[model samples]
Target: MMDILIHWIREVDTDIRLGRPPLAGEARSESLAVPMMLQCVTHELLTLDPSLGARYRDIQEWSVQKALSHVQVRRMH
Candidate 1:
């Protein structure tokens, strides 16, 4: 759930960045991975249909506490 939520966040951010108006092919091409990864995770997680709600619930909790995770990640890496 943590991983998928992180990827979901990346996809949203990437889409906002890459989906800007009037961009050229090269620029749009550079940031393709995030959305693509989002697709993959969406497929993977949704495959477990019934359990996804619980997983997503946890992700929501994590999102609400993201500042703590960001600090931890920055400190570690």
Candidate 2:
């Protein structure tokens, strides 16, 4: 199920990038929540079984990068 969800996430991202209308409950624009949730799922999987870390390493890294892309410089008032 995780593999299917991961694949679907990429598909939704592509659809948004290509300007296609989002289906029900799908994001219409880039969202920080997407990668954040993916990262959380990856973390939980690794926590459940450390041995799975190797398999999810790439996914973990990709999620981290995607989350980081949402960061922006902030100015103090």
Q: Rate the local accuracy (lDDT) of all candidates.
A: 0.50, 0.76
Index of the highest-lDDT prediction: 2
Please give the lDDT score at residue 24 for candidate 1: 60
Report the C-alpha lDDT of model 1 over 3-48, residue by residue, as the tens digit: 7556546455544353356446645333434445554555567676
What's the count of clashing pairs in each model shown? 0, 0
Model 1 TM-score, all chains together: 0.31
The TM-score measured for candidate 2 stands at: 0.72
TM-score of each: 0.31, 0.72
Clashes of 1: 0
* Cα RMSD to the true fold for all candidates: 10.5, 4.8
Q: List the residue pairs that clash in candidate 1.
A: none
